[model samples]
Target chain A: MRICFYPGCSYASTAGYKESTEAVCQKLGIELVVIPDWNCCGATVMFGENKLRATALAARHFALTQAMGFEEIVTGCNACYATLGKAARLLNEDAELFIKTKDVLQALGLTLDRIPKIRHLFEILTKAMPDAPSERYRSLSVGAYYGCQLTRPHQFLDKGGYPEILETFLERIGFAVTDHSARTQCCGASHAVIYKDECRNLSARIIREISDKGAQIITTICPLCQFNLDQAQTGDLTPRIPVTYFTQLAGLALGLSATSLGMNKLLVSAEKVISRP
Target chain B: MNKASKPNPFTSISDIATINACIQCGTCSGSCPLSDQMDHAPRELFALIREGEYDMALKSNTPWFCVSCYACMVRCPKEIPVTDLMYAFKEIITRKRTAPKNQKMPDMYRAFSRIIKAKGRITESYVMALYGVKHPLDALKNIPLAVKMILRKRLEPKALSVSDPESFARLFELTEKSEDKA
Candidate 1:
């Protein structure tokens, strides 16, 4: 029940992902040891900027994880998960790049002999939390949003296009899972910032689809997805549906108070939904 | 070597021979979430690559429009690694400074990269400010949301840096040196 955690750049800043994740992990007796002095995973931008640098950036975390006496690196952000996973896969397959990355790490007084396994926070929660202890949240319906990077290009967890793992987890945790097609839809990713109007349309489309499917609330695994979906609902003509992190819901299922789970950080208020009798 | 004689950048990151195996199927294009916004769809870019139209392929906003969703990469009947190809395109374009003038994604990415390169971490507000310098109106539009986030304590005003700054800086330098040799 112990794992090395990589919170990524946005984890601490995003809506209650860090808070609720820490709270739930503490409750579940899962020790999350954060990688000390960890750098950014380079996300998607670094690879496009320079492949070697991106690989080295992510590989740095792998070496740190190994130093921490862990074989796996668990991250809450999809970008970090994918970026680190890509670096690991590349290092494993491309010996030349691996040597170059190792040399780079060596210069910084670090070693990269072995790559660490990358995992999402969702994967850990699904395995750690048992079926809901109480049926308090059974009436609350959740639209599970997987974002884009979690399963696609890597189907280790579930089918890329239409993943049901999140739905299965939600159902097991006693929340009603709504079947929806926007599970793996892109929330415009980082580009949502530069192309606001266009990305808003994309996020809005996902929100509209989930809402139309009769989902009272939407749950997201990635911070950016939750941010894009929540912010897109602002000034939106449709009824506001709260977009929350999966950790927040898991916390609630464990009978933790909403405030303690950082539920108040949501842009569209979940007060009404969580407060329901 | 002249521009035409220069090796295709795609070959450096991935096997062009595999990408050449692209059957011109539009599965990649059809699977792309932002194909409508792209100047050329993923399949068309591959066709352009096959035709020795590297200039056109590099100049297209198709790569920038990619959100790295990898839908096309996973679903490509040919297993062409379409998403990785987009990254290769982005790297080449970024290196050569040849991104299309209409695309701001390159600048946005540069802003993001600069923050990480400096602090080894990202401050969301700082990144937005740096990226927003070019698009003041866009930044203006986000102020309300930013205010709400700040109120919720979700957006940190201060930038966070790694504890070991010396090693973090050295990593970048060493990586750049290694990349130069490569």
Candidate 2:
């Protein structure tokens, strides 16, 4: 199965998102064609600062994807997934905004007649592995964190109120899925960089909630979510639990090497979890 | 209530009608993860916007603190696009002639966009260099993490510029024109 892949800025920078995603895709026999000349999704700040500019930035990517002739594009980052989804929805719904975006694209001789389907890599992983892995892991309890964007303002991926997509995936792969309420909570995202102290407090809440629920390893689909939960531990009151990408867990289940999954680079090491008997 | 003399800020907002749709049931504030840190929660912020207190809404720090998580937007019973409403406040506040031009938050956002304007893609290292120049002490505190990232081959010292600079420049120029109409 071949699909267009948009490895957003953090894919190359994130610890396990790119490595594990590629390794898992290879194991699953999914050919991920990199979107040529791909650019940033303009993230939240862009949309907050100016809607039109944000829409134009994302529409440019859409036009590029359309040119690639792929009807669907997959991304591993929640921010990119949400930003591009919002842009695509806005482009389809708002004729005025669409016209403005088309006019801007026309200057570059590019065109975006329609929005392509924006999918998170989690959806792809679930489809690729329908049953328990041949090489199953010890039932390590995993808290499947969806962050906020992946399941919010849109519930196509899963039910927004209480998302179970991650849980279902984990359970199917032979891990004990822990149902935590804060699974869809905010991680304070980019604000972690701007307002560190406040974001730390916000991130701390999510970490505590997940940890208190007996999750040995908190697995997530978003890079920023992993970064915040993994790095937000201040040694004050919160216990440091390992946070990792869902792809990494899937790669492990598929019998991929930890080195291939970039497992060692994780801020909070998952060595113990991987070595589970 | 806002002063009656000033033009209604609520009406001026593109999505202000959604503010009227708000039941003031406090779902937005309750769902907000950072409401504890907010001086005036989303409920009060909506009230302020409804009262034509755009000045208050703009200066309340609510919009700045918003992470764009969309939790509140999803939970709203009235189906209001609450997050977009927050962005409206940001846009309105940012447009004021006397708004703090170099405030660290918006400046950082503008820097991110400008990098893309110039290079057509964001380079994390470049963003850091530019941000570090502005807030050196803050950057210094994160040296250990930066070192870890560098050791992991995450920080590419030089990133290739976007394939089509001319097109990016033209699109960005057109963006400014769209902003005027927006």
Candidate 3:
């Protein structure tokens, strides 16, 4: 299956998740084409200020992907996924919004048809990864974290509170999934920089809660969440559980090595696990 | 206490979804990291908004302390989008200029926004430099703390830099365009 990928800003800097995702996709014989000159997702701020403009900004990506002849765009960042998903849903449901946004984009020599299906990377894997092991993943316990953006606002994807798509993906990859309460908890997100102390408190709380649930290393699809959780482990009291991009884990499951998957580059340090299996 | 109360103040179309989803479960207040630092609870603020008590809610510091983590929204049994409501409350506070007397936080976000308005994106160095210039005391307090943390190797200065300057310029233009349209 071929899909247009929007990596956003976080992908370039997110450990080796981007590289691993590409490598794994190549190995899996699935084509991952990145949208060139992609702009920001307008996360949190865009929709907060102007709904139409933000939707237009998001729709431009979808328009470009559609123009490139891809029916779906897979996003690695939860904020991007959520923003694009919300925009697509809004554009499809609200005609006036679609018209206004389309008019704005037309000013820049771009015209949007319909918003493409915006799928989170995990969703694509869940749909693509078969039941039987593909000789990549043997046996591993994977912890899937769904940050607030991916599931909130009562929009597309799974129900707001209880989401299962991500969990189902990990299981298919030959991993025992941990069922934890903080699955839907916040990871400090954009607030990580502004409110350091408070953000740390919340991030550390989520990390501890996840670690307590016996997750050796937590895996997430969001770049911001990974960065915050990885950066929050400041002391020895906190068990330095590393966070991995789901694609990076998928890269490993797809039989990619630690260095190839950028496992050695993790901020929280997954050196111990990289040596395992 | 008289049970007779006025209509809710958060009656705007922008706030109806948020207000409608509020279950009055008090989860937001309980989960708020800065609940102790604030004068009232997030639940109380929502209740005020739900009941159209905008004046009272708008007068409080509940809007300022929100870190925008959406923890309350995540934990809310009713799945209310609380952070957006908090953002609405903050925009109101900004318009009223009745924000907390301590101008540090708003000043910080404003400075960040100004960087976006000027450079078309946030400049970490510029923000840090501006932080030093505007609040020399904060800079002075932070320098020693940052130095100590740096020496301890606890802090890795990952400076925020935008990849495309032209795109950021376009973003600034877009911001201006939206304002012009408005």
Q: Top lDDT: which candidate number?
A: 1
Ranking of models by DockQ: 1, 2, 3
What is candidate 3's lDDT per residue for A155-208, written digit by digit as tens?
367765777777877777766677887776777676566566655677887788
Instruction: Please give the CA lDDT of all the candidate structures.
Output: 0.85, 0.80, 0.68
What is the lDDT ranking, best to worst? 1, 2, 3
Question: How do the residues B1-182 of candidate 3 rate in per-residue lDDT, one tens digit apiece?
Answer: 33236644445435455556776778888877667666777888767665666567767877667655566766778767676667666655665577767645666666655554444333344665676677776556446445544443434355344455455445445434443111
lDDT of 1 by residue, A1-277 (tens): 7889998888888888888999999999999999999888998888888888988899988888878889999999888888889889989999988898888888888888898888988899999998976798898889999998999788888988778999999889899988888898888988887788777778888998999999999999998999988888867445589999999999999998888888888888899988892
Report iRMS values in order.
1.9, 1.8, 5.3
Candidate 2, overall lDDT? 0.80
Model 3: residues with Cα > 4 Å off, grouped in runs: A130-139, B1-12, B17-23, B27-39, B50-56, B59-81, B92-98, B101-182
| Model 2 lDDT per residue over B1-182, tens place | 33866776446566677778878999999998888877788989888877777677667777777789998898999988888877767776776632344446776677787787778777876776677788776677677778877887777787646787777777777777444322
Best candidate, DockQ = 1
DockQ of each: 0.69, 0.64, 0.21
* TM-score for each model: 0.96, 0.95, 0.79
Collision pairs in model 1: none
**Error at A161, model 1, angstroms:** 1.5
Model 2 alpha-carbon miss at residue B23, Å: 2.2
